[model samples]
Target: MAEIVLDKVTKRYADGALAVSDVNIEIADGEFVILVGPSGCGKSTTLNMIAGLEDITGGELRIGGVRMNEKAPKDRDIAMVFQSYALYPHMTVRENMAFPLRLAKVDNATVTRKVEEAAAILDLKAHLDRKPANLSGGQRQRVAMGRAIVRSPKAFLMDEPLSNLDAKLRGQMRTSVSRLQKQLGTTTVYVTHDQTEAMTLGDRVVVLRGGLVQQIGAPQFLYDHPANLFVAGFIGAPAMNFLPATLENGSLSTPLGTVALTDRVRRAAEAADAPREVIMGVRPEHFEDASLVDAAALDRGASFDAQVEVLESMGAEKFAYFSVEGGEAHASDLADLAADAGSAGVPDTGSQVVTRLSAASAVAEGQPAKFWFDTDKVQLFDPASGANLTYSAD
Candidate 1:
């Protein structure tokens, strides 16, 4: 219902340890923004500062166009749902949901109406009389959400609200939360360490690292056009692949093969005014079966060939892992790759090159395989600075 803004927002502890720095973001009315990063990345700290639970050591926070630095949490007109599902165990669902309204001395009739409406919205009508002790973990989390929803606050701030649920339940709740946000049209700011949650739930995701924001955009935007190495590695299911390469005459020389640069990337590099010491990046899904690729469609130069090592079938598609002829030295820093695979557990086969092929494609492990990518699909970054070679034309 209201826009939120953070202007050069920063947070620091009494010990002088910085928690967040210079994070400036503008959340439009009714937009669901997610703050995401790894553990100890200051996401929760930033959320807490916005909720008025933590002091801002520098910068400013504004909600609905008013400076909120001196405002009490009660006056901020924001409702927060935390990870722990902070419900009063002694009270029934109805009582728990009605507590906030009661504190504001709302009349009993209005409280009953509001609680009934919230319970119905959350599908908790049948469990209103049940105590928290008797409810399942998912139900308890719904109760936490019901409490926040009943108030109809200016915005909803959620801090990993689904962390306590099982995987299946978490997936179900992800859809439920997203649907609820849209149905209510509430402005929301959600914080999580889970990349999938950030990718799926947010209108715009703010990727942060070490107290600084890496990038802010739609989920696919960050995945397709990362601003730096950290954003490149953090925003995808199977993160973008990075290979050391040297740039000469506008082409990147990789062990696998050379990838020709597009005019956009070339222009960006030229604008940066630096010699081309760069890293070449490609998404796992960007590679195609080399034989099937149309060379005529390419801009004079774009292609790579490698040998496959392992194959993984995910029902509708296959991921082929292999090694480029001389790519053994690049194997040491695959932590980013392993992390992106999540629970599948990336195998330790030596010197592997990986690409996701379509379900209809005929490629097998250990086969001599070739892959092709559009030149524009490739991303280039400064090896030393980790900054994207291509800044936006805007």
Candidate 2:
């Protein structure tokens, strides 16, 4: 295992369009890092640059404390698992896994031992004789992973290896891949547009946008305290509910009602020199049906009644959607995020709120429902710069 570092790395096309710019990431030995962003956000370009498939426009690339900018892909000593299985249809699973070892002229016995070990780790021991044609999609992906494992390289690079599988299989493969990486203790860098994969698989996730690094941190950290409107909106499942608010006298005036900012939030906003008009963010999971919460718990938050536009029952929990009187919050960052998410054409006539409520709640579509959210969990962002205004000093 080895540490991989990108020091102020950049990639610019001949036409002068920057694919990646001033990117820097330090991946520790045996750590699993993921590069995630919307399509064309330069995540794949950054990965290819690390893999030595693309030339760096500037800066240095290092692996195991050695400069590797000029090294060829084969000389990088890293195993890459591509999105496509890239398996030889004619070769059986055992032969496919052993191919890398054979190319290195490893002795037959050693090759056999490595391939067998990898097959067992990937739970493919039963399908050693099966060709790629006879394997399930998940099994084929495991075969590709096994091929990489047999090489026993310094690090592993995977590019959307689970994108081709069905949703259920993708979830299953995520567990398998994470387990395999932990068992082998190999350094890994994964690239994917799927936030769920990025969240569940990596020790740290790198969020990118417009060829720039937006934020880098643990999944929960980024979710709880995003660096900007883009990161806040991009990292969550139902995404965050953004509402335009006016900050004055330690209180915020919003469509829901006036919210008295908590001391922590007030201090952060004051320290950041927050603007008078700010965007307030609340996650879906942070809200609950007001009637279901204890009175003591309700005292810590604010409640508002809204006409539920839609209610989705999700077994353990429920999602209630409502439309506030005010229209959607407007900003350049929001526009860019909408474009990146392929929802640029979707009309935003009103501010839409989605709240996660208890399954036992009595909320129903077209009925007036009371929703309460913790005031301390709210985040404030600068609309123009998209910077988090309520970021804690710590």
| Highest lDDT model number | 2
List all candidate RMSDs to the true structure.
3.1, 1.2
Could you estimate the TM-score for every candidate?
Answer: 0.91, 0.97
Candidate 2 stretches with Cα past 4 Å from truth are none
Candidate 1 residues lying further than 4 Å off, grouped into runs, are 298-301, 325-352
What is the per-residue lDDT of model 2 for residues 352-386, given as tens digits with 9 covering 90 to 100?
A: 88999889999999999888999999999999999
How does residue 2 of candidate 1 score in lDDT? 92
**Tens digits of per-residue lDDT for model 1 on 1-394?**
7999999999989998999999999999999999998777799999998999998889999999999987889999899999998999899999999998998899999999999999999999999999999999999999999999998999999999999999999999999999999999999999998999999999999988889888999998888778887788788866677776778887777766676677887777788764556667778887777677666764444666666778898979888886654442232123433453452255443344568888777777777766776667777677667777775624
Error of 2 at 202 (Å): 1.0
